[model samples]
Target: MAVHSPTSGPCRSIVVSKLVAPATRRSLENMSRRSGVDLFFSSTLSSAELTDRAAVAVVVPVPHAEDEVMEMVHRIRELAPTILLCGVIDVPDQSLWLFAERNGFNLVSSAGGIGAALSRRLAADDLGVREPIAVLNSSDIAGRLGLLGEFEVEGCSVALWRGGGRLGCLENRCTHSGAKLSEGEVEDGVVTCPRHGSRFDIVSGERVRGPADSDVKHFDVFEREGRVWIVPEP
Candidate 1:
């Protein structure tokens, strides 16, 4: 039982099980129409039923049957290791989501929440999600006064400063007026926003001066393998 929807633009191949509630199936069909993704509905997880071109498969397990769900997941993993697996539950259960994640499901969501979750996943992929990025070499930073540099990672403009052998990374945009902090001046470990003179402690990401009441967003950074690495904010 495969149901096709009207699609547009670049489409992603998706296989969904018909065992889900009718409302869930309708929601997925509507989501496919709006998102321009292809959908294939099946009654089971059998290899003969699933299309080889499918990139993702949404499985709906029977309610309150944890063991049966795990068995199906195992069977699917063994049959199609390349396809990303997602589990949809009729009821919202936190423990079930955790179990699915631990048992190899890439995503787990409530039946009604599946559309929104899948849409977010697609949008994240479109934006080219960012992870940890190397900013500079540890040798490039000097002791005491430290070093200051600007970088663009994962579509975010950021400023990196090192002081007293400690490194700090913050978004370049000022909290007050969207000014570029990289254009500001740094003194005694505090960076003054060039536009409104708002001051912030780079090391602590704390706003020490007025006009910018909020603290700048801080990013995790560490020195590893003689290089400074920045873990982009999720």
Candidate 2:
């Protein structure tokens, strides 16, 4: 896997090989142990195409030729491997978050290298996880001063309320189709999705509004070092 920094323009580009070319495939198979390239293999058609796009991205190292990885992904999508590994090699210079969101591909690299340090960190949930740092410190303080009870819940995303000097953490996931409640907007104590118009209580994790039949998860909230923490159940 190749790790890349978030860039302002499209990620680095590479020359994409023709998927049906036989010599290209043979050449790829022959190339071994390169010092400065990202390596990716897949066995699905869709993933292969996606990989192709990733290959020519000169913005980052093209470890695996785009065509080859795509072919691999097309071949293996049905096996459902025991593990799926992704690497975000380097911290993106810009909105790595937005890029992942737009492409629906999670980042896997934190370093820009091709060594063992580039191995995927799939088991650690927080390895590359980045969230919005609360900007309204005063609001958080107010919320904490009021203190809501702690609880565990699950949803598409996490939710918090700006009240009483601290926060009341709520499960931001919607059960219906597992839509992110955080992506929804809050109004009158309800967080409603712009996607399907699903709604829930921002404080209770209850499905007050729906296209969804299930409630979201809630978590215990706390504050330390001027930051809000939600201890979600493992």
Identify the leading candidate in terms of lDDT. Answer: 1
- lDDT (CA) for every model shown? 0.67, 0.39
Q: Each candidate's TM vs. the true structure? A: 0.47, 0.31
Per-residue lDDT value at 167 in model 2: 42
**Candidate 2 off by > 4 Å:** 1-157, 163-166
How do the residues 13-69 of candidate 2 rate in per-residue lDDT, one tens digit apiece? 122223323333333233213323333333332333333333322112212333443
Backbone clashes, each candidate: 0, 51
**Best TM-score goes to which candidate?**
1
Give the lowest summed-lDDT range of ten residues in model 1: 1-10
Per-residue error for 170 in candidate 1, Å, reads: 27
lDDT of 2 at 53: 31
RMSD in Å for all candidates: 11.6, 17.4
lDDT for model 2: 0.39
Segments in model 1 whose C-alpha atoms lie over 4 Å from true places: 1-11, 48-51, 126-234
